[model samples]
Target: MDVNTTTGLSAASALTGVEVVERKGAGHPDTLADGVAEAISRAYSRYCLKEFGANLHHNTDKTSLLGGAADVRFGHGELTAPIQVLVNGRITAALGDHTIPVADIVTTAARDYLARALPLLDTPRWVDVRPRLTQASSPGAVNAPDTAEREASRQRWFAPRSLDDLAERHRMFSNDSSAGVAYWPLGIGEQLAVGIEAHLTGEAFRTEHPYYGTDIKVMVVRHGVRVQLTACVPQIARETPDLDTYIARRAQARNLIAELAGTIAPEHHVTVCVNTRDVDTRPELYLTATGSSIESGDEGVVGRGNRANGLISMFRPWSAEGVSGKNPVYHVGKLYNLAAAEAARRLHEETGLDCAVALVSQSGRDLTDPWQAIVQTSGPNAILASRARRVIADVMEDLGTLREQLLDGKLATA
Candidate 1:
């Protein structure tokens, strides 16, 4: 990728060709779905001058104890909000049981996730995602209200019917998918807050029907954008939440794909965030990292000519540059170097396009583990020989027509 004279930014030419990458949760802290969402949404507003921005609110004070086999707890359910985890219970103990406290778990997760995602969000320089904390009582009340719907049980507790009743709330929305999004919001209230924030900021793009009642509609007009960010709640709410590993790996892959795809050369890349209710069985559409052997550095930036595998082989300097001393081939990874590329190519040959694609990409943070591609198309074409091949395919076909119209026209000058 070409760098600007002094800023060292990826030049316009670097945008040519495609780059496929994978980032796991272990490596990137902000890859957490919630964090990524918040970053994009916030960037839509205040980060206009910065690369990224973020805001978090935790109100576990409104804990709820359901009765009769239904134990639902909605304390500051946004415990996982970026950078702010309310410690409802003192942490005199360890991680298990009452040791870590529900609040601590969320706080730790937010801190850890932000560490990695902040870089991708470009929050420091070209990007910014500032995090703000709303002032609250040092230790808010147990805020638990029983919603048993009985006059007897209702007597002792104050339940929250609307987000306002809760001690904390956060909101975000965006028409620009490239913009960052909000990361935490355990219930509808937080989602509403995100939406409200976007609306109030005058940055949340309103929506119209693309098909008909399809929640998957996108609209970006003026200096605004709005997207209904969904959550993999069931998985996220399992007995034990282990999203860090999954998120970082996903980050590595996403970075690789976006970088490589953008390399298609003035091809007008399109990014689609296909959220899944089932992260385990349903792989995200654009979430998979596959294509060519060439790899990217920390923020999806790649070296020159490192990706010479497939269709990208047709493009000049399709991937990110390898470090000065490292073997360029080795830098791209064994998968892209030979075997994986061959396997990826074979699928396209047999199916004319990779119907069930494998997510391919090497992660510098961990060599032994390479992220697999999810079976979904970022675009139409398949034979992703290099960064160029993959991105061109997606931009030409993957981006919905309406979306293309919006970006090409509505946001073209914007």
Candidate 2:
């Protein structure tokens, strides 16, 4: 592998001008898509492992959610049209003579996730779960020579006859060319952004403020030590009886965010704003029936919201690969991102310095190694470079544990 170690300004230190960070709450449409896709992936992996003794090849990262139409009033609201969720991806639906219940798996997972994500919505009444899975291989697979080896490979691509037909069980290989980027030590602005969103969508907050919905978003813009925090959160129609209550709830949310920010970063002066679009003259508000914009025609797609890391930092290096719904066993897009993040965290712990890591994988390479590995430290020190490399090596070697964590839904993806 090609290893490069260098010294440079870390992402936090490089924040010279205005830095922007965003965090989407659990009920956001894009986050919903990501959560559902990941749920399906984990459910399918568990089923395949339990039934067939191996995880099947599948990439369910292409999931999408089309928002439903809703009619809302002061104290009542309902979905006029059902929301449509398309779980689209490739999967090995069959093994030998037994056909895996792909429909049951996808829909069950979708319903289970929706029930948890949007507690106010009746999933069975207002949501439609559609499984659009296929068992097709990549077009390039057909270009191989007409030999016995090619036949064996094709068998393992999607429709494996038995455990012997699964090649990854012996030795896992990277399936795509991709890169994973990660950095350690979340800045104060990042922490506040994430914390505000979590507090607004959390069960404790929701229990007290049932008028506030889960469809929440926090944006933090920092100029030096002063931070401006803006949030867009939906007010539940059932809990909000009138315009006054809605306005009051919005103000309450704003104050809560400001208080939470102070707790998270007392050094930074944070100004909070909520529902900037709301106007005194307008009767309409950022209200929802189910506490989510998805109940009112706001669509969502996987990979369009948060990155593998929860917060989206504008100044930090980011990878386009969506970690959720990816195969945890061999897909470098998922494994490498998780690895790079863990490596950065370990390096920071070991050296007491901010760390950044980038790992690139070539198709067909061993999963334990990457084609290129780059490590950067906040300060200039050659000795720290060696220490960073060792920390990264340890992370790469522990990918097996990472895979298990991923299958168990223990890791945060998106």
Candidate with top lDDT is 2
- For model 1, residues 147-231, the per-residue Cα lDDT tens digits are 3333312211123232233221221111011110011001122222222222221212212201011111111111112212221
The TM-scores, one per candidate, come to 0.17, 0.96
Candidate 1 global lDDT? 0.24
RMSD in angstroms, all models? 24.8, 1.8
For model 2, the superposed segments whose C-alpha errors exceed 4 Å read 11-17, 143-152, 382-385
Error of 1 at 98 (Å): 7.9
Lowest lDDT sum, 10 consecutive residues, model 2, at 143-152
Candidate 1 segments whose C-alpha is farther than 4 A from its true place: 1-33, 36-101, 119-263, 266-350, 354-414
- Where is the poorest 10-residue window by lDDT in model 1? 175-184
Candidate 2 lDDT, 31-103, residue by residue in tens: 9999999999999999998998888889999999999998898899888999999999998889989899989
